[model samples]
Target chain A: MAREPGGEKIVNPNPMMSNGNNCQRLFRLLLGLLLAVLAAGLGYVLSSLPSPAPGLSKPVAEHLEASGVSNPVTAVLLNYRAYDTLLELGVLLLAPLGVWSLGVAARHREPLVDPVLDMLARLLVPMLILVAGYLLWAGAHAPGGAFQAGSVLAAAGVLLLLSGWWPGPAFSGLPLRVSLTAGPGVFLVAGVALMFAGGRMLEYPPPFAGALILLIEAAATWSIGITLAALFAGGRPVAGPHR
Target chain B: MSLLQPVFDIVLGLALLWLAWRAVASPDLFRGIVLFIAFGLVMALVWVRLDAPDIALAEAAIGGGLTGALLLATLARLESGGGAGTGRGKDRESEPNDE
Candidate 1:
């Protein structure tokens, strides 16, 4: 508050930044207190909650043997809720397609000449590929899965790109499109083929479920890897002579 | 030893809160983004502590790693386009008003 020449009291227009940082400090203190109170309330409520029952765990486990995967998470993801997985793959495919639709040909980024980066890429890329393969294979009985493995593959691709070892144009055109769409395409065909066999859409016969799931996971992993790398590249890779 | 777990949990909770606050309130955009990435990593650790390994893996990979890379890449692109220091200074001034 201040007194004007007219003898009237007036409030300051800018409370913060005019008081030599004190006002801003006070404001932050108040905000922090408010947030702390809210967090405490939430924590208190959550602490009183009872343990949740296994709503779908029993059913999922009961049918796990028939789902053809030893891991319940894999069975749930690739078998019971296969439609959701298919749609997720569709979303992955759509992202790169949208990026490509912008039609900005990627400007050639100068490849890094740093020895350290080159050595790191050389060492890590092969290891990443091996781990991705192992993850995909182990998803049947472990926490590893296509998404995690695909992300590792994508990381390897990003590393290669950053090191300038793999140029963006090398992955353009028909092969790119095939790899991008292979997941959803394979999934769709599998689902339709099931219909011919008197099984519902996306329902694999118990005997063949494991093999079909492995195929779908492989395709999805490859597609996801390509999609993520292409998104990182930021433009539609133009078809070059190498392609 | 059993009591140590809750103590660890409390410490983790406070660290998470501090990281989140710093990430959101930092004036420097690049610093804020880096803080956000760190927050994601800590959150992944929390997921691990909660016994959700799958979620922990995804969060670390996508949320921390990929997102940080994407944000840095975007910052570089913007800087290259509009000149340096645009991320920290003149963010509001340089951005076009879409509305």
Candidate 2:
């Protein structure tokens, strides 16, 4: 709150400077207090909860047979509620574009972290990728599916971003473009193909419902992974400065 | 209060709020950007607890991930040729020149 000048220090020492500092400190303090209150409320909800849902889908159960995808949540996400997933992809598309527009771009060197953290990221990456694939495949019977699987993959992308591997903004290229469009593109084409062949849009024509759902989900899974990784890169036009 | 849900919820919530508060309070604009990314992830978890998987996925993938990237990129632009923070200061300095 004190300032020194060549000769002006004795006069006022810029009372405005002290006032600005006080305002900033007060702002931070109030912000912390607000956060504390929010945290307390959140703590109450998280630590106190009801039992988990039975992992069943009421809509799927009521109208149709299992379709052999025993995990009703998977069925709901991939089949019954497939449209929601499509729109989700749309939001994914908008985020990066917004970066290029609303955000300024940068061309920075990447950040450096503790070697131990780097090692952990390295170790976690491949394992998470494998787990994601397995989860995607097993969604037919387990409490996992495209969404969960995609998240795990996204987690890996995040790890890559944090670890200075994939970098950011400069992520634009063939692969990124491909991954971004692949999910909904495949579904739209497949649905059209089925429609042209006399089936309904996204209608698998009987027993293949599960298979079609799987394919759509697989595409979605890959798209989600890429989108997340790139999105984690945010709007920076390039990599980041080493911190 | 049931079982593990509450525990996860509290962790998720506090983690998010901390990030938000820090992002607001951080003196170095760059630090605030990073903290905001963390805040996004924690909020994604909150969406999950609310049983909105769709929202959670979007939050995690787009909200948390891309927004951080954008902020970092902006900081990069602010830094550009010289060095990041210095470049930003230079840009600030050049403001009067443009006028």
Task: Compose the digit string of candidate 1's lDDT tens values, residues A5-86.
Answer: 2312224457464583566568778997999999999999889877794489999989999999998989999999999999
Q: Lowest summed-lDDT stretch of 10 residues in model 1 chain A?
A: A1-10
Model 1, residue A93: C-alpha shift (Å): 1.5
Among these predictions, the greatest TM-score belongs to 1
Clashes of each: 0, 16
Task: Estimate candidate 1's RMSD in Å.
Answer: 7.4
In the range A1-243, model 2's lDDT, one tens digit per residue, is 122211122233566987766776697789979999999999999888766755545657874554546667766766676667677777867766665454433325556767988999989999989998987888877656776677778878867766777544344555567788888888778778888989666666647877887888899889878776665555434334422
The sequence of per-residue lDDT tens digits that candidate 2 reaches over residues B1-99 is 587877878878878777787776665567778778888888887987897665675577556766676577656644543323322445454322211
Model 2 share of native interface contacts: 0.07
The residue ranges of model 1 lying beyond 4 angstroms of the native Cα positions read: A1-50, A105-109, A166-170, A241-243, B82-99
Q: How close is candidate 1 to the true structure, as a TM-score?
A: 0.81
TM-score of model number 2: 0.58
Residue A210 error, candidate 2, Å = 1.4
* Model 1 Cα interface RMS deviation (Å): 11.6
